[model samples]
Target: MVEPSVPRLWRAVLPICLICFLYLCSFLLFFCATNSLIYSTVCLLRANESYCAEIDQNKSLIILEESIQKESSQWALYGTLSFAIIACFISPIYGSLSDTKNRKFPIILTICNAILTGLIITIASIYQGTQLCLILYIVANIVNGFGGGTLILISSCFGYATDSCTHKEQHVQMIAIIEASLNIGVIIGYALCTFVFELHTRIWHILLVHVLLLVLALVISLVFLKNRSLSQPSTNNLSQKIIQPIYDIHDLFVGLKQNHLLISFLILLFSLFFYDLFRMGSGSIVYLYLHYMSFDDAHYAAYFSFEQLATCLALILLVLLRRRWKVNDLYLAIMGLCLSLAAPILFAFAQRNKAMIFGAIPSSMFSIYFAVCLRAIIARLVPEKDKGKAFSFVALIQNLDVVMGTIACVEIYQASIDFFPGLVFIFAATTRIIALIFILIQGLCVSRTPELLSIMPTDEIEEPILENQSDDDNNNDDELIHA
Candidate 1:
């Protein structure tokens, strides 16, 4: 009997890779532009006879720079919180919509939101050093959040990939590829920022680049991506349409309450939650920390690009380990947590550029595996129909984590900026330790009940057949399946 032929891995996920690449490139660029704009605005305000002007020129300049850094850090914190707060409420609805309506729509909506956000920020850059500029920044965050921000786009993309694959292995590989695309996008964005800013380009110029990339992403998404959600009957009632997503979310929680895997699921959820909180907490204050160390834009870009590249390499290693050694996802996740614990500790003590760059090395060994494996584990625990809900809840938790992490880290950084800016990194390290404990508990539970997280039986799982097979080929396939 002939074996079934699955599509090549690259072919199966190429469209998603392109879409994610374009979106993340623009996404990273937008943040870099915003940070530059904020710094420029603060500098402009300082030059306009602020409190620092009363001192000697050299001392006054030093005081003025510190003030600018603090204000910019505060604004960054506020912007992150506002966006997360809005996306938190809206992500679940979009997640349900993807499961019920279609995946393409939510993705398109997110790209449109990104485009609008770029435009608003560009306009604000024109009016820098004014109250109107600040207002426009606030408005951009609100609009971006309302459209579900990056959180929805990522969840929807993952859901689409999940729908395309038929088994656990395929799910893990596809998810890893999609995540790698995101990292590659960030690398390109940071590289571009470094090159452009080195040439002394204006802030708006970078913003324009972001808008152009977003437009390309939008076009590619429309043309190349297929709607993968299973077809359901269209509903015409307006109120029902509005409330259905909420009902889906409610149903999700109720289902979770009833599942035997509830404890395991919660353990994974909290583990993911704390890890994200650690990531966001440290990430939100990285620029401030670098600035405090007197590192410039090029330095920051280089550091970020290195970090992203390391993550990509780690993901590649994870795929190899799963394919070559048949490692359990839970064991790999535990290994990842253990390996990554050194990163924040390294960061906490880093005082020089070399020290900071060294931190990315240990992180490269396994920092990303924890999130990817945990996500795959969660995906496997639920039924196919609940994949979207599972990912959506993850998205919601991530945004909420961002809100809490950013606020807490930012406040700590602000309070300790003068005496010890590395306190925030220590805080991040603590969160990772907590996440590690929860994952250890999960591993223990799985050890006792080995079937709890086991993959479905291969014979019971049907491989998707191609549409162009001949009658004889179909008969052969059927024979192979039944044999």
Candidate 2:
């Protein structure tokens, strides 16, 4: 490989990295904003008391199961589902297009979408006294779907950079940085939720903050983030060329079907399913239980924060220890699965011990850190050209899991309203275990492909070997045919 002129590489590639940073910033912004609103909204339905009293009162009242279902029934649940599915598909479509198209095009599109989303939310907040507010919310959600294109944009550009890298070890480090952005985003988002909600009781306040951050992120993206090159050599123009109707999705699905790395990708996908299912499902139940057992939000928040802090530290430790950890990608996944599965049991027992942090940290670490490995694995498995499609397809799987898992959690909570509310979390955790078992079976089923972490350099990632064509070939054949 020709020694890459570091300057030219930086110029061509740094903008996408800038955009990726913007995407992370916006994601952290939105996620925190979403947490603030959702937490506030849910809290509104529960113990209508000061933060301190609310915790104590809620545990004994045990009416949250009823409250949530009543709240859902009051709204058209399908409306929420509509918001998610539409938001789900838009990111990849525009992102895949951006792979060949200029950076300006997608950035402009996302900006327009974010502005529209902001305006819609602003209007909804203004008229929130009327039923029309819900109508406005639906519109805002649709607009939000449009803005979701940022995730794909972020993923595709990283794929571009990953493909262009000359060294194999660089891939792991890059993947780690990419995912570190995500993990840190989550940590920051949760903190924002606590801070933002304290300032205003209104959901509108939270939504407005989300919009402003996104708008700012978009502006940064448009002005500074840029890459002028089109398809160069690797990753072929197959994905860049669109002949099929579902060209983007088709590319990902086609790869998963034929690739030897299917087991690895599939395990990560299922683990993500557990990640959302258990994490989202268990959230309130865990908190309320802590409140019941500990008797105050101040105390419980301390406990919750401690749990997250410990888990976040664990993520840092895992990234550090990853060098010495010799386990296959499968082993790391199983370790994560075991941790996630253990969280609920620990949570269930923590009530007796009154140490929420002690129980929750292991699970949180497993779910978050294991996911990082999964993405890193995929980055190693798939060729650089198709990273966008692979990552987005994985996103699709994870999000789809979220919808179903939420449904199951909601169903369990609804059925057990009169019973122990903690049961909802327990049920969700059980569902996750089932998914985990399947993942274990799949991991055990495939043992032939070399461990990705060993085969690929951690600093530079491995690109899939393109066997037939050499650097001498003039005509580009990006597709890899195994015979």
* Candidate 2 displacement at residue 244 in angstroms: 4.0
> Candidate 1 at residue 214, lDDT?
91
Mind giving the per-residue lDDT tens digits that candidate 2 earns over 1-483? 433334444554555555555454445444343332333344444434364234334555445534643354224234345455675666566556555554345555765676677667666665543556556666776666665544445555556556545544444445545555544545555455556545555556656666666666667666765554354533545644444226756666577668655666666666666656655333334443454454343344344445555665765665555545533555665677677776776665454466554656656666655566666666767665566667666655554654465466555655654555457657756766776776666566554455433443334322221222234232223334331
The candidate scoring highest on lDDT is 1
lDDT of 2: 0.54
Lowest-sum lDDT 10-residue window in model 1:
456-465
Worst 10 residues of 2 by lDDT: 460-469
Output the TM-score of candidate 2.
0.72
Q: Model 1 TM-score?
A: 0.90
Off by over 4 Å in 1: 1-5, 48-62, 234-236, 455-483
